[model samples]
Target: MTNPAAAALIARSNRLGADPKNTNYAGGNTSAKGVETDPVTGEPVELLWVKGSGGDLGTLTEPGLAVLRLDRMRSLVDVYPGIDREDEMVAAFDYCLHGKGGAAPSIDTAMHGLVDAAHVDHLHPDSGIAIATAADGEALTKEIFGDRVVWVPWRRPGFQLGLDIAEIKHRNPQAIGCILGGHGITAWGDTSEEAEAHSLMIIDTAADYIAENSRAEPFGPALEGYAALPPAERRARAAALAPTIRGIASADRPMVGHYTDSDEVLDFLAHAEHPRLAALGTSCPDHFLRTKVKPLVLDLPPTAPVEESLARLHDLAVAYREDYQAYYDRHATPDSPAIRGKDPLIVLVPGVGMFSFGKDKQTARVAGEFYVNAINVMRGAEGLSSYQPIDETEKFRIEYWALEEAKLQRMPKPKPLATRVALVTGAASGIGRATAQKLAAEGACVVIADLSLEKAQEAAREIGGADVAVGVQVDVSDEAAVQAAVDAAVLAFGGVDLVVNNAGLSLSRSLMETTEQDWDLQHDVMAKGSFLVAKATAKVMIEQQLGGDIVYISSKNAIFAGPNNVAYGAAKADQAHQVRLLAAELGEHGIKVNGVNPDGVVQGSGIFASGWGANRAAVYGVEEEDLGKFYAQRTILRREVLPDHIANAVFVLCGPELTHTTGLHIPVDAGVAAAFLR
Candidate 1:
């Protein structure tokens, strides 16, 4: 933070990176060259500060900047090997560190350091890439910017590409930047302000040129029946198909999913030329690295029957894997990194939009965004000239490059529930919220479902925002509402791998005091609601074909036969039996159904705050505030039960430790003998 040059470099990077029009997430690098007093020699030494590997520009900090000695970086030119050996130079950047090196140098480090400018930026703007991927890109660049920018033919990013750009800069002294053919753009200036402006100018000029010269209907006009379906129908279909697609995508390894039906994506998919252009795949390295070489597109029209489309999806998934493996076979060399994955990361269903999968939700979402960028690039390229991306062989090389392999190896190991998604009912507060929080901490993307949408969303944000959790409203007693909540989970994070049937209500009443309405309400919300939730989410788990867990939040009252608790006890007892029944039936599908029985969770209990606490206190002959302690006194362990205790029980039942646990109730009631299984 003390270094002025590095601070200014971060500022400039943030400005350029804040807008998607400038660069996609974590897709570009920026640099500033300045003089720093050496600690050992006490002499001014030239230092190059650049954005490091695996860091996003917008969120970059001082530690994310890689500082290298300029003289040592330029020295790599003396022993420069041929293009085939360019990758070796990346390791060499480590030796050129000015200090502790800040962060690991990226492959684009040489490009930033070698250029003779005080500041430099390399970006993957959609407009710039449009011209870069155009068939007539070189001439188009000349026509668009005249002498202000030059064009460099496609070269894999490495030491040699850096030298290529440096030479181009020397020859064209008047040029501020150049379009990297079949790639992106790089701009430079004597100051940070000028450098950022030059980058924007190049991007803006390209966008304007495309706009002026592009012909109408660049995607070759929308096919009549392929247009997007109505909003409600589109979402319903998306919800129906997401699980199957997700299940297929997770075959290689479990993957979290993200769904999008943006106008840009729908428009592109609806066009006549989409089939041909999509087959060619994305041009930029950044695009395909996340999105994969191509998407798995449903060949059927948007209006196809749901069952018919489901059948075709299975066929398409099989074909996609085969095609991907063949692509590897065709271009893979002996030294190529072993095939990473054979599944398509992006799945395109014309009316339903796109579904992208990754190890986590953020990655899946970003992959989808990158594909949108590719769509924009394709639109622009086809508008002016025919879209022409690098050949498949080059894409294969970059996809399996040793440097990329090294980056992947550097990533931290995933958590136990890393790729799993969980849906917790009544998650807006108390035990349900605590359970949702714990599951999310263990790395599961969670759906916080409560009767109140506002409270559910609030809890979700508190848990970790949209990346890790989403909120939806549902009255669990309503079958239709329960299905919609499950659908929301599928649409938000692929399929549901875990379901917590925790939504419930309590009415402490004796046989004479309890009315038909009270009995129906308590049973309706607890026993029947649990059934509805389990049934709805089970469908998704079945579709996933991956083993899952469903835990019910029953009560100690289910067995203790406490006075004036007849209605509540019966509902809880019903839930306990339902767990055993469903576990027996669902075992075939790898879905484990379990229950947690808790002794009067009064503190932080929404049920207690909603009048059940006073009613239970009256039955126990204790003050309302003393109810938790009174319940604890009756237990052998004499420990007050909190929401977190029940939450921990839920986690133990569903977490890695309980892989074989099901068809049982774990008492989290501090050893209540009456509640023990008998």
Candidate 2:
């Protein structure tokens, strides 16, 4: 943080990375060469500070940069083992670290260090890549940039590529940058400001040239029947198909999903050239790494019948897997990394939109964005002339490269609930909120469903941002609302793997005081609501072909005959029975149904604060403020039951530890002898 040069480099990297037009997420590297005091020698030494491997420039920090001695980096050229052994040079970078290198050096370190300029930027801008991937990219570069910018033929990024660029820069003294054939662009300057300006200039010039020369219909005129469907219809169709697609995509491993219905995706899918262009796949290394070689595009249009489409989807999935395996077999060397996965990360349905899957929500979302960038590149290339990219063999070389495999191995292991998505009803406060927090902490992406949207969103924000948790308002008793909540979960993170039926209200009243409305309200929210929520989520779970969990937050009153709790007790009893019934019926689908019985969670109970505490206190001849203590004293354990205790029980019942346990009711009520299950 103390180094001004590093601060300026971070600023410049962030500015260039902030826009999708400049580069895809985590797709570029920037560097600044500056003089730093050598701690041991007390003399100034020249150092290169470059964005490290796997770091996103927009969020780059000092710690995310790799610092190395310039002299050591340049010296590698003399001993360079040639292009065949270029990959080994990456390991050699360690010896050049100025100190404990802040982060692992990237393959592009040589490109940044070898260049004579004080600042350098190598980015994958959509416009730059369009020209780079065009059939006559070298010729187009000359026409668009003239003498100021040159062209470098395609070469896999490595120490050899560094030498190539440096040699080009040295020979062309008048050039400021070059359009890299079938890759992207690299620009350099004496200062960070000059480097950024030059980068922006090349990107803008390429974009303007493409715009002016583009055909009237870049994608060969949108197909008549392929136009996007209505927004509501599109979402409805996407929701229906998402689970099946996700299940197929997750065949190798469980994956979270993200859906995007942006105009870009829709427009691309509707075009005539989309099928052919999509078949060719993306050109950029960053784009295909996330999107896979090619997406699985549905042959049917969006308006097709759901059942018919579902039937076809299964067949297409089988074909896609087989094709992916064939691609791997054709290009994989004996030493190539084991085929990563046969499933397509992206699924494209004409008229509907795109559904992308990944190990987590953010990754899934980014994959979709990368695909969109690919779409733009394709549009520009087709408009200018013919869309051409590096051959399939080269793509396979990079995709299964040893260095890429090493990077994957370096990633941290996933958490227990890493890819699991949970929907917790009544999550705005009390037991529901506690349960949501605990689930999120364990790495589950949660949907905080409650009657109050504002409160639910507040709770979600507190748990984590949209990636970890999202908020949705629902009246669980309303079947439509319950279905909508499930749909939201599927759209947000593919499908639900866990359901917590914690939404409830209590009215402490004697038989004489209880009315029909009181009974109906209690049963509707707790009993009927639980059934509705279970029914909706179960459909999705079934479609996903992935086992799921449903835990009902029942009450001790379900078993214990407490006075002045007629309607509330009946509702609890109904919910308790549902746990056993659902467990029996849903067992075939691997869905475990369970329940939790808490005696009296008064401390953070919304029910307690909403008159139930005072009513129960009046019935027991105790002050409302002393009600919690009074209940605790009556319990065998003589301890208060709080919301978190209920939450802990929920976690255990739904978590992996109890995978073989189902139709079980956990008691977290400080030993209530009277309520003990027989």
Candidate 3:
């Protein structure tokens, strides 16, 4: 039986074909299909569809419509091709469809079949065409829509690509559409109109953004790596390297073709101007889970000091491991398993494109995708600044989270810390407010202590939950005030099981011109204040026979001294030391102490607004408007630290999950500490 929508779709395709700009031969095509189910039988009865093939959509018609039995077509593809036959396979596929009283379907029939939606439409809109043409196009898409759209890199279009799309749809049932690298877009919806509207929106938005932004220049020539090597030598090196990669990889390694001739490849090898190349085309979180933050960028020249190069790569790997270990040490539960090993998922030899090694296919695939996305994102963000990921420590905790494991247990509504009480200092804003909110959310009664009484009350009001949180005004540096606040918290919440010392002031001054008064002031606020809070909180926790979590808010400056900020640096340095001392002394009393040293955390607190933000802008002699971009450019992840990021760390440290963790300083600086050494 004929479907009205299918007929209209055929007419629309023919009309579109007449428009010159819309009728580009090789650029894109549109397809529409109808879905119907028998009423009592409740099964798909027919698929009447028009699929545009080689002909331009602008000049297409009913003749371009391919009619076929959907069920029969599915059966043909079910037991599809194996490795050996190529031409024979193609001939067989064509013969079966044509001989079965069906016209040739769209080349994208396999992909369309994967969608569960009643109507599916695919097109390479002009706007998408412009975006896909750029080197960092995929990243630009993410920067704009993030997870709202799924992205698939360019793959040789056919069965394999179809399978990939099918898997993606299965994984993400709610995806609006997907953008194909160097291709166009595929959109699906319950109705034809909805799908078309989604496609139009994606393309129009992408095109508008591209038009507003400057066009990207073509990538320069690739640098030299294997291209400089003799042909035989290059093949031998590849063969030799293949086994090592395979041995460590979770699955069979695919042979990587060497770029011994392309000038673009050679240029990329010879220089590090394009760090994105090392990361590009990798899948998301997959690459991150397997390979970690950054892959090693190997320099192949003999004169480049092979030992130094290897050492640098090894150092990068070691740093990743150390950061991971530190994160685990800070947030691991007493019952959590130990971390296994540290091996990067992917490596980039100067001359080679990329080598992804993983414990399994899933890991390798994830690693590859992450690197690819990172590359594209970095490239796109380069125009604005750079794409900075979260810190190594933060990533590690997320990757090896104990709570994530706990989720696997599927225990029902078990409160791990039902009777616990927590005290959060500087709870009026920033990390403190976030921690207080988190603790209350997790069923712990909380005390919000802040210098500003109004802000404290506001914060307490915001963290509204069954677990009550009360505000207390206290100057942490004033010993009497801190003691009183702690005492009040104990009276209100019954006792304290957690203490988050997140209150501190930042005072920036050059060492040469720094006043002793400023140095003392910084020390009093950060170090002395933390000590008083710990001392007061410890009494309540110890008396209650409850081991508690005490977290100090340090800074990236603590590790790498800040420039023109001697007072702030000195105070942070001391704060870190105090954490260690507190951990040691409090251990006997079953108390845990830790520090969260965040780098470049912006927003939330007025620390940056009153301290670094105001001062750094003046120091750089730039307008306040430009400081954010300036700082963003200077960092690796290029992400400004949000208060939630820091607060999340504190939550992990204080939660029942970290019962065994203590005496550690975790850096939430997005690898800024390593940047200093680099």
Candidate 4:
């Protein structure tokens, strides 16, 4: 017989509306029993109660109990497959008996059998289902329950599933229960009442939550056009239309099915601008694992040729695959694994709902849940803004992150290098000043390295010192001044990790109009000065064995040959190549090297104003505003690059998180290279 407290808790669970339809859509049985045996004596000890599979806990009775020898039941799983299912599966349970007759054990009986606790209870709660169906549900569970609960993504319920739960139980001996995705939960305790009480509390809390936040309002009104079609006609139309969407034909028809009579669907069908339907279908990271990045949006006119539609779908899928391959090729390392499989995780059928595919029922459910959550979030966040999927490089890093996988096994902690210490040349104002400010905001200490003593002091005062930042006047072009700055850095903060070589002069003149004096001045300030600082910093770093980062601020003109500014371009180009060589030689020593080529970094910098004032007057015979517009329009993204953007690139290079990256030049010019190529 069930304990009175367990019975009450089950009643509360049902009152809270925590029960969902059983897996077979029938009234299912539930029971609670305990198994106790004296290991040393090899004799029956005490009978513990557990919930039976077919009984409902809300009105449980003692007669619903299933009795078995705890030791015998536990051993059966290890040897069950060896015996024929007809004789061995249910026949073995007859050896042990308690008050009432024994019924077939829960499908998860093996899992319950392995637990040493006295009392156990299991329930199919609606709250658990709702949380499991949401995006980032595992994280949400952790937030609510702390470490008391363990979460396992959806898996089939059977013998193999029981083994999986056993493994988790072994790993987390203290876990009270696990939230199984697309399924319910299993809560266990020393007393049946305690187990059932906790289960009731959790489900009640979740059900209350869902009730409070549920959005039952329709997204749009029903449409007469779709409602006019017969059910058979609608099903046929959906199936015939499915193949037109790449990767959609293979997916199971949506279990919840598509919206046949919604105003949103009708409006979508009327317009050619429905690519957003696919973008809206992706709202969470889980979907990416299932669906790849983007899905095809199918919107075919009634008069369109069937052959053309089929060919278009095939072509779209092939193109997407090719793009994926190109991204992998560009970002994948030699140690990277081969592509796992080729199939889109989700597909958008224009005027219809989204379709999600997976290899199995559990995977399919996960994909579908992710798709729905993503669509909801996208809809909620400012009415369906476009989603920018992570680039191929980032995806490859995530997919092949062995170190990250290893780290997941342990608890995480904050590191000392979580914040950076940066030294910026000519940082009193202009690009240097802007770069220093940007770095500090991103959890970095800024040392304003400049030649002007007064300006450095003033800039430092303005930027503040709470962030562990200061100003040091040092002529980077001067060897003694550079050495003094390095010594000051070591004395002030034990070490420095990032150096930005931004101090330089630009002299614009055609090659034929250039003088030897102009060429020497440009090289000394840009090339030689960068080398001097790097060499001094390298000596200090090698001794301390604390590798660092160095970023040279080059120019877009370095990549594209121009008529004038030959000296500046040549010097900048040399600085870039020098960074690559430094990266190769110093990589083993744990130092990274990179460069940034920014196009139009105006605002705070005197360099941009000075260079632009001269260039606009001489080249375009126009004012500065017109020149800014001209440069901004020349870029493919049609945006002017800012000093903050360049600083961001430099910060990325200096970050310890990017340890594997080196010998790279990131152009922070808003797709200027693509424009130049065109």
CA lDDT of each candidate? 0.92, 0.92, 0.60, 0.57
Clashing pairs in 1: none
* Reference-based TM-score of each model: 0.99, 0.98, 0.39, 0.39
Q: Which ten residues in a row have the lowest lDDT in candidate 3?
A: 250-259
Task: Count residue pairs with overlapping backbones in model 1.
Answer: 0
Residues 1-678 of candidate 1 have per-residue lDDT tens digits of 347777788999998889999999999899999998999999999999999999999898989999999999999899878787888899999989988748899999989999999999999999999999999999999999998999999999988889999999999999999999999999999989999999999999999999999999999988888999999999999999999999989998999999999999899989999999899999899999999989999988889998999999899888888999899999888888899888889999997799999999999999999999999999999999999999998998899999999999989999878999999999998999999999999899999999999999999999997989999999998999999999899999999999998888788778999999999999999999999999888989998898899999998888888888788999999999999999999999999999999988888788999999999898878999999899889889988999999999888888888888789899999998877898
Compared with the true structure, what per-residue lDDT tens digits does model 3 show for residues 413-475? 634444466788888887788878877776667789999989888888888632367799999
Residue 247, candidate 1: alpha-carbon lDDT: 91
By TM-score rank, best first, the candidates go 1, 2, 3, 4
lDDT of candidate 4 over 377-405, digit per residue (tens): 33222222222333444445544444323
Candidate 3 vs. true structure, TM-score: 0.39
Which wins on lDDT, candidate 2 or candidate 4? 2
Tell me how candidate 4 scores on lDDT.
0.57
lDDT of 2 by residue, 1-678 (tens): 447778899999999999889999999899999998999999999999999999999899999999999999999998899888899999999999988749899999999999999999999999999999999999999999998899999898899889999999999988889998888999999999999999999999999999999988788877878889999988988899999989988988999999999998999999888889999999888989899979998888777899988888889889999998999999988989999998989999999999999999899999999999999999999899888988898899999999999999989988878899999999998899999999998889999999999999999999988988999999999999998889998999999999999999989888999999999999999999999999999999999998999999999999999999999999999999999999999999999999999988888778899999999999999999998899899999899998889989988987778899999999888999999999
Clashes of 4: 22
